[model samples]
Every structure is written in structure tokens, then in C-alpha cells.
Target: MELKGIHHVSALTANAADNYSFYTEVLGMRLVKKTVNQDDTSVYHLFYADEIGNPGTDLTFFEIPRAGTTYPGVSSISATSLRVKDDNALQYWKQRFIEYKVDHDDIITVGGRKIVSFRDPEGQRLKLVSDETNNGVKGGTPWKKGPVPVENAIIGLGPSHLTVNDPDPTIKVLTEVLSFKEIDRYPSLVQGQQDVRVFSTGEGGTGAEVHLETRPDLPRERPGRGSVHHVAFRVDNEEELQYWKERLQSARLPNSGLVERYYFKSLYFREPNGILFELATDGPGFTTDEDPEHLGESLALPPYFEQDRERIEARLKPLDI
Candidate 1:
């Protein structure tokens, strides 16, 4: 089965209120869904994305208070890369970051394209790469009314980089199992000799590309705030989702079983590098729980948690976004 692109990149956060403000207020992404994690209702599961919460636009967070910082190493999604229009768009964000004092670096070229590295308030690694070098700019519309205007708003995800000790096994799973093509290999932008391998989809866009940062010297990373919990690959619908489940299990990869995420159907598993990966469908999306016009207006809970809404609400802190 062919995969479209990335669905969403989920990470951890220590405080929901701060995570909400950083993504919504600083990053200018819309709060598409304000919900709790189904299994762990005590912690908030917040989602940020373009208006209407398109599949590729999702960048979600699980608020685990004081989750601490991560130590750089293997088996970790080191950076979640996002795309902007061009150098002009990169400059737009640079000025915004300058004005707000957001921790970031000046524009740096990567694989012949410009990218500005930045971090969220909770220390989650992120970078903004220009669309100048991709096959074509994504067609998805940005939320024009957001804090950042349509001209400067983030287009969608770019290459969510994964750092690992060995790239062979993970590359095997991606090429043979997931069917992602090894398009090109480039010099490591972040390390010497350890060249980064680029794998892209037959269909390229939001979740189109992934960069394997092969660093054998670095130790394994510990789970904590600022670290990506999982990177989801897009499936057009349930049929695609099921096909992948069988494919992964057939390859002898242990999976999380089928999980009902309310808005989407998901099957999760870890790749060779110990980085968690997910297969997520595009339908029954954010609008399933709330109207398009008023998504993320209030705290939303799954059916199982509906009975204990009051207690859950009281336990979770209100988002200041």
C-alpha cells in the first residue's frame, strides 16, 4: 500500500498552558482540538494545526507536567521540521522571532535549501525550512486570520528528522516495509561523516520527507519534554490503515494493536531505532467532535471520559490561548 505523507508529529510538553500559548500565540497555529489523552485522562492532549485541522497539519502534544529535558542521542526524533513559502517567509519568521525573543538561529542552508532552527517554549526541537527546494509547494491553505498572516503562516510539516545509531535496519523498514523511496543522500547538516539519508513519498507534501540523522557517537535519548513521542504517517482511510497493520505485523514488527483515537484510527509501533511510529487515517477528523466554525473552544473528552468530566476538568489546567 502506498502512503501519502506524514499525518502528525506528536511530542511531549510539561505544561498545557505554556504549550498552548507557544504553538497558538507564538507559532500562530490554531488550537484545533483541546482534548485529553484517552488512556491517560489526567494529562491534557492538545493539538495544533492549520484551520480545520487538516491531517498533515497536526502537531500534537501530551502535557506531562515537569517531564524534564531530554538528553541527545539515538532512538529520538530530534527535530520536527516545518516548511515556509521561501526565503521571504523565512525572513518573516526571523523578524517575528526577533520581536518575541523566541530561541532560534539565523537562516542556515540545508541540502541546498534555507532553514531556521528554533525551539518551542518547552524545548521541543523544531526548524523552519523554505519550500524553495521541494518538488513543489504544498497546496493546503493556511489560516489567514491567525496571528501570523496567510503570507507568513506555516505551510505544513517538512522533514521530521530522526537520529539513530544505525540507519540500515530503519531504512529497510522504510523502503521495503513502508515503501518509502530513498530519493537522495546528503552530507549531514548537523554532524560530520554521518551523512543524512532522505526518504520521500511517491506523493510529496506535508508529511512527504524524512531525514535520517545517523549519529553513532551520541547515546540513546531519554523520553521527556521537548522530545517527539511519535511520528505518524498518513493513511487515506480505514482500508489503508488495515493494510499497513497487516504489513507491519507480517514483517514481525510488534504493534500497539488497533487504537480508537476518537478523531482517527491509529496503529502504533516502534522502528529499529526504538523511535515510535504511527499509522493514522485522515477521516473522522477534528470536526467529528466539534463544529468547524468553533473547534477547540472548550475542553473536549472522549465518550469514556464523559462521565468524569468535572473531575478531569478540575485536574487539568485551563489553556491561556
Candidate 2:
């Protein structure tokens, strides 16, 4: 079975409150889920997306109050992209970033599309890509009531950038194992390096691409605040997730088989370069527990964690969104 585009990219953040402010207030994405990390109940796990949290639109963060700075290097998810409606929307965002004092670079074209790179307060490497020419997997609707104008608001996630020491092994996993097709390549921003490769899966476009940057000279990344923890690709449903688990096993790729994430089922594994990858189902989404209109308004816990809600709430610092 073919995989859909990206499901979500989860990153690290030391301060949930500030992370909440930047993503919601500045980026104008909706905070679709306010919850705790299932693996670590002591910290906050926040999700930001378009109006309602659609599978491919979510950008999540796991709060680690004492997390240190990320040492950028190879074997990392170097950059995460958010899609805007068009090139004109990129212009609007450039001026908005200026007005809000958000750190950003001038708009530039890459891989035949315009993009503007930027960083959050915690130095999360991010970019806004124009979807004017996109015709594959569709983007989501922007939040109508968010701070940014609806026309120029961030819609959904685009391609994720992966930096690796040896591209061959990662490329093998992406192509032979996961069935991503190499579609294009562009000169690396770093001088004298090989051109960055672009790979895409089902319904290829901005949303379905993985840009591979080979950095043989760099060391392995030391992940902390602002570092992407993992990038997940979307599967159609639980049955498809099971098929993927079997496929990973058949390929002798070690994985976390069929994890019940509550909102979605998942299977986690690392490509040969040690970059974490997850295959996640698209259904039983964020609306499973929270009402659509009032999502992210209160602390939400899965059924299993409901019993410990009081203890979990006691440990988390109040986040004002």
C-alpha cells in the first residue's frame, strides 16, 4: 500500500508557554491539542495545525523544561517547512515577520518554489514554502480566527529536510524500503557539496517530499531544544499501519510495531543514518476526544491516562494559549 504525505513532525521545546505563544500568536496556527507526552507524563506535548488538526498539518512539540541547545550537524531533521497559499503569501509573511520582529531570511527560490527560512525563539529551523504550483496532496484550511490574515496564513506542513553523513543507506531506506521515488535534485546551499536530492511518495508535491542533504563532513547531531525528534508519514488507517509494520519486519528493519498513539496508530523506526521515522495512521484524529470548536482549550488525556489526570496536571506548568 502507498503512504500518504507527511503526518506530522514532532520537535523539542524547553518552554511550552513560549512555544505556545510563538506557534499560535505569531504563526497563527490553531493549537488543536494541548496534552502530555504519553511516554513522559511530566512534560507538555503541544500540537499546532490548521483550523482542525488534520493528519498532515500537525506540527507538534514535546516540552523539556531543562533541554539544552541543539548542536546542528548530520543525521538530523534539519528543517521543517510550513506551506503558504502562494508566492504573494510569502511576501505578506516577510512583512509580517518584520512587523513581529521574527528572525527570517529574504525569500528565495529552491526546487522550483519560493520559500522564506526562519527560526522560532528557541532557534527551530523552519521555512515557509509557497504552494501556488502544488497539485498533489492538498493543504489544509487556515484558522479563520487566527491573528494572521486568512489569505496568507500557514496552511500545512511541506517537505522535511534530512541531513545525513552517508546518503546511500538513507536513500536505500527511503527508496527500497519506504517506496519513495527520487524526483529531483538541486545544488546544496553548502558550497562544494553534492546536490541535495528530493524524494516523494504518494501524490507527490510539496507536502510529500523529503529533501536529503548529504553532510559527510559533519558530526552526528546532539538533539535538544529546537531539534526535530522525528518525522512521521501518513498511512491510510490502522490496517495500513499493520501492513507497514509487517513490511518493516520483512525488510529486517527494527521498529516499534503498531503503537497506539490514541489519536493515531504508529510504527517508529530509524533509517540507517539514525534519523527517526514514523508511519502513522490518518484517522481517529484529534477530534476523538476534544470537541472540534473547543480543541486545545483544556488539558486532554487519553483514556488510559484519564485516571492520572490530577497528578499529570499538577506536574505541568500552566500554559496560556
lDDT of 1: 0.84
Q: Which residue window of length 10 is worst by lDDT in model 1?
A: 132-141
Scored by Cα lDDT, where does model 2 land? Answer: 0.94
Task: Show where candidate 2 strays beyond 4 Å.
Answer: none
Clashes of each: 1, 0
* lDDT, candidate 2, at 302: 92
For candidate 2, what is the total of clashing residue pairs? 0
In candidate 2, the residue pairs with backbone N, CA or C atoms under 3 Å apart (3 or more residues apart, or in different chains) clash, namely: none
- lDDT score, candidate 2, position 188: 94
Tens digit of per-residue lDDT, candidate 1, span 193-221? 57788888747643588889888888899
Each model's TM-score? 0.96, 0.99
Highest TM-score model number: 2
Model 2's TM-score against the true structure: 0.99
